[model samples]
Target: MSELPHNWVKTPLTNIASVEMGQSPDSRFYNLNGDGLPFFQGKAEFQTVYPEIRKWCSEPTKVVERGDILLSIRAPVGPTNIAPEKSCIGRGLAGIRSETGISQAYLYYFFKNIEPWLSEQGTGSTFAAVSGQFIREINCPVAPTSEQARIVAKLEELLSELDAGVAELKAAQIKLTQYRQSLLKAAVEGSLTADWRTKHKPAETGAQLLERILQERRARWEAKQLAKFADQGKAPPKDWQKKYPEPLEPDTTDLPELPHGWVWASVDQLSESVRNGLSKTPNTDQRGFPIFKINAVRPMIVNFLAIKHIEIDKSEASDCWVEVGDVLATRYNGSVDLLGVFAMVKDVPVRTLYPDKIIRMKPVTGAGLGKWMEVCGNVGLSRKHLVARVKTTAGQTGISGEDLKKTPIPLPSVEEQKYALAILEDRLQSILELELPLEMAFKQSTAQRQNILRAAFSGQLVLQNPDDEPASILLERIRAERAAKLELKKPSSRKAKVSV
Candidate 1:
């Protein structure tokens, strides 16, 4: 689509290369014994520049020679790799070899530049696939053989430098993740607020706070019992405690020590309740009650933009409705890292109900405590514990409500927690500022690589050499060579008469 050199010309790919679609051999002929030839089915065998040999075929069907460019034609559609050795190729791949006056490397880069277009051309009901004709018909900019060599050399030099920069940015990203984890570890371990604690004493110890929470819980349960009896217009049960048992205290054997005025507690002791959300699928009506799925639970906060609406009546779904400051966690995911990932609700645009894949918790102490718990659930020590408890089945990892409730949490005095949280927020914000730019640069490097390829293919990457032969002359030579080859393959008139 861009301007090209005066000596360059545009030509169909078939003019310079032979395209061949591969046919898969019978599965009975497939083997891993290194018997006949290495077999490549598709992208699964593809590496950076060449296909990695995994399985071998005892009875080979279609084959590609060494240095031939192999293209995946199914689903992914456009990744190209050079054949390192003669190999059997399956139906999911096609091979291209230079006919004359073309470099295999130049063709590889040309295909690389138009990968997006090739992917768009793919069509299939079950999975996207392209035919051999598609490859043959695709137009490519042709450069003189000498100019192509120069362009490829310059492109590789520039791309290698860009790739190195991207690698550095990725390394920095990994370090940033490690740093954030360290910051959370420090917050929960009491080391972050050790200096602050020395300057300002806590108003109340963690043990005293827990005692007050227990008393409040007992009183609230008793009040609920009285209200229920009043509503029924019946005498109170003589032994209502049997029906509504008090919550059990968690065992803290072998648990790690906490700072002075701090204690170890379970999620159940800290939260008013931990429960899973509605199990039914939501209706498509956008005006209906909004529902949050596992995807809505992002790091630190819930994402309300991608929410779906349920058709259930507002009054009927009230029990599963969530409010601000409630901590939400993914109850199950195909990835273990995503399982039990937590987020706290901030602002709601509409009344929202969480889906079954998410579990919601309301802290008994305060919203600040809920926020702290959400952070703890995602990082270091506590995260390792949670991951260890995850049960996996059929590729999905899950943690039950009871298991979540039993998660051990480090508790500091309310004042110290507030202090530590402020520090953690400031440090994490600094890390984010650093992270965002690195991520943007990584994206830019990818775009830069694509630009280099585009320029190289359009004959803009290297200057045209007037002394070099023009592409028009090279193409005429290739056409003449192909015509001679076709003449050689044609059957003689005498041989045809003898056969008759």
Candidate 2:
């Protein structure tokens, strides 16, 4: 502890405030129809600075009056907010009220300062929680009444300015996200490479490119069939054509218009093969083969660190192994925001498999096209289509493999894609550079708020006034008043004997 200014004193919380632990009411008495007192269970119901009333209790067990500080004591411990109205608090919360000499606002700020320490002292087997004793035992630096008032006022003024800065930083982050989406939207719409198209016309249109991809696919399939025949020690069958069915072209009547050389194609038409991965649970052994889960599929890049290990047979491993340039997508997630999210695999150090919730797409046109497809998937037009196709059950959402295969993609000439990607990369890089400083500013503002609170409680935020009463004298007066109140509540000895 740092040395305090003259007349300032260190005081335990129990000396200056009353702490009340909450008891939950019976579940049968709970209702959402506003039949009784507003109930708060924990921090899950907390808004920016208040608890949002989601449920009510007909018979409230532990009640807190308006102006009392409500503190969460379970799991995420020590976030403090004021009770706006009289309400019932459940087992996960505690109510605190300041004594006569201490300002309620001053106590709130003091609790805010000690929040981190309170969180550290929390204990539990599954979820950490603080006991009622923890709240009573925490010490605070006390100043004279007049000084505490001045300190709170000054601290609020400083924090309000800091909050404004943080809000602006968050607004910038939203703008950055919007700007990236706009860049991708333009790239897919052919507006980004409008000038480049005039300088270098495509040698072949998208329709012709599709023809070449189909031809390549057929050639590869034929070669595989012949190799299988050789492995079986037999000649190629004469009627093999009757058994093999060619890939089907998707319906294009409802598709949107594209640029002169661009065409609309489904993911199935552009990719060599699109397959979902294994559904088996992974083992805990670190030496097992690494497999990518839904979390590994981030925007534009796969997070290798998020991969889990699995023990698999050699045949299953061979079928699921992912190659560099394979585009992976999340097939299922509880959040709609994560469904249909794409990530491109840039490199694989060893054999890697992906989980059933992740689909791997190997594009015949190479990694460059795969990257372009990933960007297209994130833009508003494609995102709307993908999200519309998603089916939801309970809290989880999923898109079937067939629905994903039918996702519309705007096909640009390979050259134009390369050019547009180059421009988009440069612009996106600049936007990211701007975001770094804003992120840093947010972190710094949080630290500065903590610094302001540190100064306020340490008798340094405002100048000490010698004319004001010292905190020690104020504490003695409060103790004397409390003692007198307790004495008044005691039973009279003469009356008790006569009644018996």
Candidate 3:
């Protein structure tokens, strides 16, 4: 509505077009093969040109003819496409018919630029709705007919190239992600860094060290149990203590042959303590204590900005507050792929995770280190074992502490464990450094596409033609035709006053 270029004008969409909102045909009328009329539903891609069509309805209600632009008005908005064939659309869409006043291509590009503004004006609580009146009221920038065609041609030229680059970047990212997983699988299977380990022979073996740690952990647990009994002034349940296995050995049949002297043992045998986070009311205010949840646990680095807020009581403050070297494991998820994904809390300086979704484990014996244990736990050997134990259902998948306690792990000697961890860290850190630039490159490609769109819509992309016919003449013709149609729609004066 404000100032424009030399030949440009501002106008309300209502003056330039007729709007038709789409409605869904009754489900009972839908047929698979009866006189095929293609049905259009709003999707992320261009709606009309796509090869796949899922729904069809015989009883027509909201019809869209060829060349009309169809825009999604609910759920996800702003996806607009020109219809290529006669079709019925669902309640989720709206069709715009240019009243011959504006070029179809010109209106398409105009909507692309102003879609964000239109979305802002949309009113609804759960899902946004853009009514016919809402679309008509939207303001648009106008140019001469010939100038609009020139702009469209220029935009198509640059946008096509940007789209190609984005597709290539996406493919590269997928390959890089696959490579990372392959690298981890190789490391766990004794394929990566095997030559280095073979060159050095330790006098002590991993199996012997694992067995000694299990014994030491059992002794500590027994001592703690005896102390609890004395404090309560009562006798402990001897049968209850005897029923559970104290230092459960790993099932060797589940794994391939390991490097010599590497022993398999259950995860619980080496644990000093296994605990979950505290559940408390969270404060949404940014200034309050920062808390973390299942989503904050990234693959390599912790995403600090993903933190939430939680208000905790002073009495229970000491119980769930996170310290460095605590391992966070997800106990519940819909997919087994995410069931037991673990994140190590290293050098954390904030209060986090006053919730039960994240399970924390600490080593009971001094024989094992946290970093080495984290690497072993995350590698393919442990992850596969954990996933196999998930209880499956219709829509639910879960893993419990008892299931975690039974996970078989290949344990190495303390000295070898330190060396193995160092090697793994060196390789993973190098991969992370390589990954960052690729991620940035992919992001930059998308930003460039948006920039091209911005330039094309702003009249800066193409030259304006002075000799071509102006849009003002076309508008006058469109207006006259519409007035004639409206006159035809008018009832005779004799019948105008009658009520139903």
> After aligning candidate 1 to the native by TM-score, how far in Å is the CA of 184 from where it should be?
0.8
lDDT of each model, Cα atoms only?
A: 0.85, 0.85, 0.69
lDDT of 2 by residue, 1-500 (tens): 47999898888889999998999999998999999999999998887678898999999999999989999999789898889899999999999999998999999999898887778888889999988987898887889999889988998899998888888889989999888888889999989988888888788888788788777766766777899999999998898855654554555676678888988777777777888999889875675789886788877878877878888787888878888878888999877888898778888876678988899888877798788888877774566678889997676789988777777788788888888989998998999899999888988988888888888888888999999899999999989999999999998878545654
Indicate the residue-level lDDT of 294 in model 1.
73
In candidate 1, which residue ranges exceed 4 Å CA deviation? 18-100, 116-136, 217-236, 245-254, 283-287, 473-500
Kindly state the number of residue pairs that clash in model 2. 0
Query: What's the best-to-worst order under lDDT?
Result: 2, 1, 3
What is the C-alpha lDDT profile of model 3 across 213-254, one tens digit per residue? Answer: 767776777777878889999788866456435654457685
Instruction: Score candidate 3 by lDDT.
Output: 0.69
Give the residue spans of candidate 3 off by over 4 A.
1-3, 16-106, 114-132, 230-254, 279-283, 286-289, 333-339, 363-381, 385-408, 414-416, 488-500
TM-score between model 3 and native: 0.79
**Deviation in angstroms for 499 in model 1?**
14
Colliding residue pairs in candidate 1: none
Model 1's C-alpha root-mean-square deviation from the true structure amounts to 4.0
Please list the Cα RMSD from the true structure of every candidate, rounded to 1 decimal place: 4.0, 3.5, 4.7
Single out the weakest 10-residue window by summed lDDT for candidate 3.
Answer: 43-52
Alpha-carbon runs more than 4 Å astray in model 2: 22-35, 53-59, 218-255, 282-287, 311-316, 348-353, 484-500
